[model samples]
Target chain A: MEEILSKLYYMTAFSSFTYQVAIMWFIAFLLLYLGIKKEYEPLLLVPIAFGVLLANFPGGEMGVVAAENIALEGGRYKNLFEIAHDHGIMNFLYYGLIKTGFLPPVIFMGVGALTDFGPMLRNLKLAMFGAAAQIGIFAVLLAAVLLGFTLKEAASLGIIGGADGPTAIYTTIKLAPHLLGPIAIAAYSYMALVPVIIPLVANLLMTKKEFEINMRQMDKEFPAKHTIKNIKAVKIIFPIVLGSVTAIFVPSSVPLLGMLLFGNLVKEIGVNTLRLSSAASGGIMNAATIFLGLTVGATMTSEVFLSPKTLGIIVGGFIAFAISIAGGIVAVKIYNLFAKKKINPLVGATGLSAVPMASRVANEMALKYDSTNHILQYCMASNISGVIGSAVAAGVLISFLS
Target chain B: MELFNEAVSIMIVGMLTVFFILFLIVGIGNLIIKLSNKYLPEEVVPVKATISSEPSNNTYAAIKAAIDIATKGKAQVTNITKL
Candidate 1:
């Protein structure tokens, strides 16, 4: 009977599963439910939730080993190569993609392929709103510090405000690798909630008059015809100039912004590189995102994710997102005080880097207030600029804290 | 207290850096657009010309003929070139 019991015990996951592991399994199920049923960031969340489940299962140790006993071979820092060599497939994905800091920039390259800077170029002033929205990142940083997180942890937590998932992940990995799971989850969750959160903030802040303010450039009656120059020269020159300037100013951002501009250059350089553009944006990008989501989720083992700090991260993330929207709206209001033509304050709200979602929500709110006011084009200017602004903010944090 | 002070400084510097860089891009992007618009504006393409060996059988000629009739000879097809 004892021999039979021993054999059964060896076969069962319960024999090794702790209560904390059980709780983690439940949390993973919750993430899966949110991803599949609620349809919140399903592309990322589904893989992440599955990874969490796998990580918690019996004896595989399907997670990156935490930073421990490391005799530095060079420069007093642990060698990533040594750390990566010690683990399984999940660790390979984690260290190879996340630790080496390769995946975020790769994803940014794909984003560049899909993005158009025409709207932002047309409304140059709207880009300021994108910059203003970054205030939430810093605001949350202060809040996190007040709450007792280290400066690096606070910075990582604060970046969730930018609403840019790749930047959040990249910054967190660099500054505080241990906080990567919660920070990534917070960033992506709030990003997926853009349609909900933006409107809530916009409605609370902007009056009907502000929403009714029709953006001039979008007005058909305005004869200036603020369309993007279809010249291939402009397309070729813009990315090169932007990339060069970004690299010169913020070398830290070069990895993310450089790849972004490179991908855009490849697309714009013409039909000769069309295949390359398609592959970068399609196949390679998808692969990186899958691995990124899964490994990040797997890192959220019970011991790492269930701490008191996790709650602080969640609350801090929400504050960051909310305050960023408020900052944008406030900036627009201040701009209106000085400008001849007033922009819709809701456009400022879309300054968060959630892209079309934040901009679309702004448009929806505009339409609600005045059926004729179409500010999506104007809103997109701020939306795309927010991407750049967030990258710059990440660079600043990396430069200062790291 | 030191952490608080550091966080404040980070907030100030980070926001300023982001704004400065983006503002520079905006200024440069706008300047480029304005310069391109001024120096190398898009050509004012009134109508595309159609070229065909058999002008009467071509779609352009048929459209031209329809336009001529509709306008009562007020308009004429000066050139027809294939797209």
Candidate 2:
């Protein structure tokens, strides 16, 4: 009886694996708690946490769960979390979605469709605001280089400052795939926390006097004819012209810019609105978001995420974002010098990669400063400017380095 | 002392070089955006409800003839024919 009991103990399976699985579950629960309770970027994070829960289980699957090396008879597994050595469903998910660089462009097309170019057109000054927001990219690059990260690694690390999650992922996947896990997580986490993160940084910028101004009226709806004609030119030529420059100069950036532009072009010409809108709002975006969150979570598998280097990346990303804000503020002040009318400094805060959130927060902050002041439109101008500025910066970096 | 001077000179030159480079990049970006907006912008706009044509030789005289004597200069009137 004693010998038989010993054999039974020896045969017990997955004890070690079980412990790892439990830790992963706790982390997933933590993500869920923060997403729900904190109300921090809930729309994206809720789905992301659910994806993580599905991913962290033994042989974590994409949407389905099963025991054994089993499928429906001859079908293959698609789960993202399998034993480390075994290429579980997770492996196939990473291979088909991430390794191929497929999700971002499709998402970009949606961004194009949903994006309104009217604000950017009405407030051309916003372009300067966009340019100012990119200060963090170079500042972080310099810091990374000084810290002894190799040049390629430094550049990859520096891109976190852009604050745009897709842009960061696109750049890093091309430049340093090995660092993708930490980089992507850090980028997305900050993006998801934009509402919390930006307001604190923005509050310091304007005095009590500045915060009281109301800029809601400045959110002028552009004249319909101007929008109908002007928007197409910007939407159509923007990707093509920028893509060519980025590709020809920084060939390394071609994959990212090319696909991003193609997606935008689909929306600009307004052909196949169904397919384009679906890419943005339907299966592709949802599936990609789920995959992006899960695969990134898979990377957090204790062995990889628990490191001094990962911590460094996170800290560096925050600094980069703050620096971007300072840059935009400074740009606004400089523009004020040459132009007759002045813009609120709060608008400068929107230059960070958080896009419209920075603009909204800035505009709201202005309303706090004064009831009569209208600066949202002006802030939006800068917000759009930052987008172009970062893309241009990416093109510049790739051109010089590649 | 000699080494210190060389270090100072190198530091100054390095700082200047970085400053100039940053200025050039940002300056060029600003210039491109400004020039594009200036050179490529929306066309001129014309106001509605203001007539260019005149029934009389002088627009002022035509206005005087069209308006009521009591309301002259307060609410100028245009000729019905012009409408």
Candidate 1 residue pairs in clash (backbone atoms < 3 Å): B49-B81, B50-B80, B50-B81, B50-B82, B51-B81, B51-B82
Model 1 C-alpha lDDT per residue in residues A152-189, reported as the tens digit of each score: 99999999999999999999999999999888888888
Q: If you score just chain A, what TM-score does every candidate get?
A: 0.94, 0.79
* iRMSD, all candidates: 1.7, 8.0
lDDT of 1 at A342: 76
* Residues A1-402 of candidate 2: C-alpha lDDT, one tens digit per residue: 999987776666343356656765686788788779987666556655665566655534342222233233566643444432355566556555665567655555455555554566555545656666776777777776666565556666767777777677666655666577678767767876666666777666655644543344323332222222334455455555656654554455455556655656666767656576556656666667777666645545544445677777888888888888877777666775775445566777787657677777766666555656756666766666565556556655544444
Off by over 4 Å in 1: A69-85, A216-231, B43-48, B51-83
Candidate 1 chain B weakest lDDT stretch, 10 residues: B48-57
> For model 2, how big is the iRMS in angstroms?
8.0
